[model samples]
Target: MDFRLTDDQRALQAGMRTLLAARYPRERLRAAVDAPHGRSEVLGTQEGAGAPGVHGAAEPAVDRRLWAALGETGFFALRLPEEDGGAGLGLPEAVLLFEEAGRALLPGPLAATQLAAGLVPGAADGTRIVTALDGPGVTAHLASADAVLLLTGDTARLLPVEGGTGPRALAAAPFRSVDPLTPLHRVRELPSPARTAALGPAADAARLRREAALLTAAQQLGSARATLALAVSHARHRTQFGRPVGSFQAVQHLCAQMLVRTDLARAGVYAASLTEAPAEIMGAKLLADSAAIRNARDCLQVHGGLGFTWEADIHLHLKRAWVRACQWQSTEESEEFLANELLMDAAGENAPGVWWDTLGEENVQA
Candidate 1:
């Protein structure tokens, strides 16, 4: 079984990296963070003065040009079938793209928009921005979205935004966000949405949730890898006591630990992408969330006091990781789900030991 990336996959990853580097440079990211509402300024406007539907401050949190560029690259449409005018890629490809997005800390409702491609009109072309309500309560980037996807149990509803309708009609109030790039809106109550599309049945909704978890895990993996790179670069150049900080044993150990966590999480993300199993996806997200958060902390440690400054990108990575951790599946929820799977497996006719022995026998024959 070959685990290596194919030529096309490698190309896709490289292309996304190049695009993000050019379009969403660190400078651009910092500027976006500093801007009052993305590129727009709220002079004396109240909190919800011109939110999405109300017509006050509808300034989107994302850059329209960059969003269009992503669409031109077929980012949101990556998984749509070719017959549907998409790139006709699979989940693995989507994961690769998301990992690069994470590395760059690209802003906006990326996962939601990507998931909306085939189901929502104009989504595939990136003309329409879509955000999702993962579970309930606050939805990220609601002010910028053209539509909202509500996943309630087995049913997935697509609510279009027009003149204070859909999610806007549900009484979306602004919530102070921790990550500057992730603008959140609190949904007080879920009004019966003007359903534009009822996407498939229970099976499809389940698949969408699973896909979301997997892609988010991939993003976490990207952040872990990026932080590891940042730490390594900073340690190599920063001098202390007439020697590079990287030369010190303590710094080396920190970097080594970051590398281990990142690689381990990467393996899990890639494996889950292939299997698409609910348990494996949850486990991947668990590893990725930990790796992303811890790696960013270690990265800050590697940078010493400099990392604590607002200008430093390390804090941004840490803040974004913290936010991502809350999405998809929380640590406790993932742990509980994995524990149930383990107990169920152990109780089955194929005991853990037996399963291991069977695997060993197969490996021996091979």
Candidate 2:
């Protein structure tokens, strides 16, 4: 099937790129990382302060201004109902927006906030920066979020940061993050949440996890594509033995391999975005992780000494990709799940290796 984007989707992608290029430029990203507080100050006052549900303290790790920019574009409201003051879009649109965000290296608790819309106070209007903790991983942008959600199984516990409604946080401080753009912290224990909501039935947790994985996979796609371009550019310009590195067969093959990995990942992620089956989602996540990690490494290899330097942004993408790969789902877990899925299909279904289509849709409501 032809996987071309629709005219509207193309317009959406281009608009996102244009906005991000103007707001979250490379210079702004570095400045935020190098800033004293790990990010720029709150951009402005909340759009609707003193309203019944408004809380003006939900500044994210990036410039709250940028979050406001996203709010202006209805970024957080993408998946919400139009009757409930949202854009009334779907997961497909969200994944595409995230792909652009990843390419620009925009940083924040985007997934958490988008998921939190309409569920938590001030969440939908970008008045609240929401962050979530699932499994045993370091939560990013902890300092910026006004509310924290402890995601366990099919339940989400809302923990408000102010008025002592939040969990027993270890004294509100930012942990030094490997990816400076996305700061994180260690939580020893969380007592309980202020409010709780059932995520839904039918492996909703896994489905939500899959949705997160898909967006993250989009980020990985962006990272892979960016690094591929970086490597190819370096190959064309950088010379060795009085000739451009592109002339070398070894470098050519390395770039070719990177391209192959990226394209495969793109295909898988787009496909999984449509199906959203755990098996398909896991497959997409696995391919995305591999592409991002491998492409960054290959990009680094092509960049050689410059890539290794602290000044180089190549290492940043690689580190972030590494961190992102392990979030929500791990490579080991996804591999096992896919293996079992294949096994079940082979043992019980029509035949072994039935081309992955007969595995059945999870019908997960993400």
Most TM-score-accurate candidate: 1
Error of 1 at 334 (Å): 0.8
Tens-digit lDDT string for candidate 1 (88-148):
8898889999999999999888888888888888888888888787555777767567788
The segments of candidate 1 whose C-alpha lies over 4 angstroms from its true place after superposition are 37-60, 163-167, 193-197, 349-366
lDDT of each: 0.79, 0.73
Off by over 4 Å in 2: 36-60, 163-176, 193-204, 349-366
Clashes of each: 2, 0
The collision pairs in model 2 are none
Candidate 2 residue-wise lDDT, 96-168, digit = tens:
8988887777788788888877677677777778877775456776656777766765656666675322323
Worst 10 residues of 1 by lDDT: 357-366
- Assess every candidate by TM-score: 0.88, 0.82
